[model samples]
Target: MFPGSETRAGRLLVRARRQGVLLSRAFGGPEPGEALFARAPKPWMRLLPHFLALAASASLLPTTVVVLLGDYGLPGVLAGLLGVGQAAPLLLAGARPLSAWYVVFSTDVLTALALLLWGGPLDGAAWPWPAPTIVGYLLLCLPLSLHLARRTLVAVWLSTAAAAVLVGLLRPGHSPGSSVLLVVLSGVVLLLGGALRERSEAQRRLAEQETISEAERSHRRLLEERARIARELHDVVAHHMSVISVQADSAPYRVQGVPEAARAEFTSIADTARQSLAEMRRLLGVLRSEGTEAEGGGAGPELAPQPGLGELGTLVESAVRAGVAARLTVTGEPAGLPRAVTLNAYRIVQEALANVVRHAPGAEAAVTVALSADGSALRVEVVNGPPATPARPLEWHGTGHGLIGMRERTRLLGGTLDTGPTAEGGFRVAAVLPRNEPAPGENA
Candidate 1:
């Protein structure tokens, strides 16, 4: 032999031994806490195994006992013992299939030996594996194949075949055909059961994957909505910051006899506003990059200037053109409000009216804008009567993005939004947006 041949053989032997150990573990009996049946999704399905067990036990137990006594002419005690042994496994199989199989297989081997030893009438009846035993074992294999690993199932089949062969050899001429029949039938049943089990597992995995994918999609959509809101608000806020910077820088020149301290304060305000604008631009750039990536490497459509309270009239007019009976009412004097407040208020009204148009076709919608008594806040309410036409089918639902956008807008501006069905079988959306922007670290 070569110098390294012994070492190579030793390595091969070690590898083979490790594989053998893994196979043994794979084919081992059921682990503690292993379930014989998977949890059924429906409540009614959970009772199916119990029903099957009860039916099989009631029928098979007596039939197996009668067959053993009549055909094999075994003593009544031995026949009854074997009968109960076979039938008991059916009841046990639902909770512990491998254990039940062990019981049934052992009884089968013992029965074969009993037939061999006790000289019974040599009628042309199926020996060793009687009909009832065959049926019960086949039923047991259903759960076994469903629950056990493929390697364990293979091991079980091999063991059954080995036992059958051994029994046939012991009783040389006494019905070898019965053994072959049992083995073939069991193999076919186990194969079908295994196929069904595999398909069920695959479907379960697919459902779980789909659920996970949906959650991820929802999360991504939420992030995209937030980014879109930020981008819109950026335009409003950046404009204000630019105006502040301009006014602060021009304050001393525009006003007469400005004090030195006042000029320094104006200079400080201008510098702060410019710095804020620079920061906002950077944030906007990041948002745009994310938006481009989200849109598959292309920029979104060009956005129009952000809308405000003034556009509410046009919005209502558009809704009116879209088959909605819509009217706009402004209460109290319209005052100059914070740009963020006005923009969010417009969006809320727009979304609310759009919802009415889509969900309540041919419905009359009233858009009411009320300025608070002290001009501290503005209340925007959109209420629609019941649809004159039949509503859309439940399946034709929106993606909820409109509501999310409205809520986000209101929340950022430290507002209160209430939405629900009214007594008149219509939906009402009411938002109260504060005139001032939310302070930093304020909760909406």
Candidate 2:
């Protein structure tokens, strides 16, 4: 009936299912003392198991049918059950691998026992080392190596070896040599599986380290930006405050109507401003601890006597020479005012004039500083027409920081600023500040 042909085919089918091409995806293990076991497996690796399962089902099912057709004198039911059992483990390996291994092992041992009890049923070669036995052992070993832990693999391998030895010793004709071979096969499968596990673990660690490094870089950038803002604040707000302090300190002798008490009051404002300036400098120094000047460079920009409302004429003259038909006019009784108000008025005019030169080249402009009749507030306005030669506006783009600086300055000093294009095809920036703010420690 050509029964050996069917039996040999079944043996090969089972061996292919266990410790076959799918399990031997990478044949060699890592060299001793190598850094882990290389990298991750390919993305298509999961598909390999399903392929093996398909091939195993095809081969194992046919072998069973052939054996049944031959009518090996075994019970028809037993022959059918044996075929189903052999294929079941290979099919089950996809989802429930460990259970599949146990099924393969149990079915192999029981089939051998059943054949022995039936008194040489089917005339197959050995008791347990038959075609089904080899196939079932391999099916268990391949997937077992994949899913089990290192220690678990070791335990399973040892257990399988012990079972093989026991089967050989207990069975009359089974040899110790086949049992030894089975144990060696189990060890080889486990070594392959351990190497893959190490590779997967190493990849996970590398991904984690990349995430941490990115977070640290983002935090470093945030700190650098904050330091830059501190330097700008020191330049704009602190500079003006210092000028106010100096002006108030010397106003008594410079002016005729100031009383001794008013002089002392001015002295107090100057002392307070100086102390504030010192604290601000210390804060700036701390922010700049990252490096020298840390982006703003040294001592801010130097100027002649900290120019303010007093230098409005010089600023206008500079604007006129730059080709803007410029005018500066002072209105109302121009008395001494808070140093902050004076500095802000001068800067507002300066930035507005600069914008006209840049965005509205060849434009007419006017600068006006008007003190209120009651001397409670001061208003500064600069207005410029749109570029006469629209084809070529000045292109040396400023840092885009001029207007932001102006707004920040007005906001900190408790002032209101309005700026935008005017209905006359021109631009206007108007700011008003309280000329007589309450003295330090005085209620607003």
Q: lDDT per model, in order?
A: 0.72, 0.61
> Which regions of candidate 2 deviate over 4 angstroms?
1-55, 62-73, 119-126, 176-178, 232-237, 251-272, 290-444
lDDT of 2 at 243: 77
**What is the overall TM-score of model 2 with all chains considered together?**
0.50
| Model 2 residue pairs with clashes | 14-135, 18-138, 18-139
Q: For model 1, which pairs clash?
A: none
Provide the clashing-pair count of each candidate structure.
Answer: 0, 3
Candidate 1 lDDT, tens digit per residue, 275-368? Answer: 9999998887777743343355444442556777788789888977887777787776445566677778877777776666655664544434
lDDT of 1 at 251: 100
- lDDT of each residue in 159-262, candidate 2, tens digit only: 77777777766665555555566677667877787667566445544545554554464456556545644565566568567778988988997999998899
Candidate 1: global Cα-lDDT? 0.72
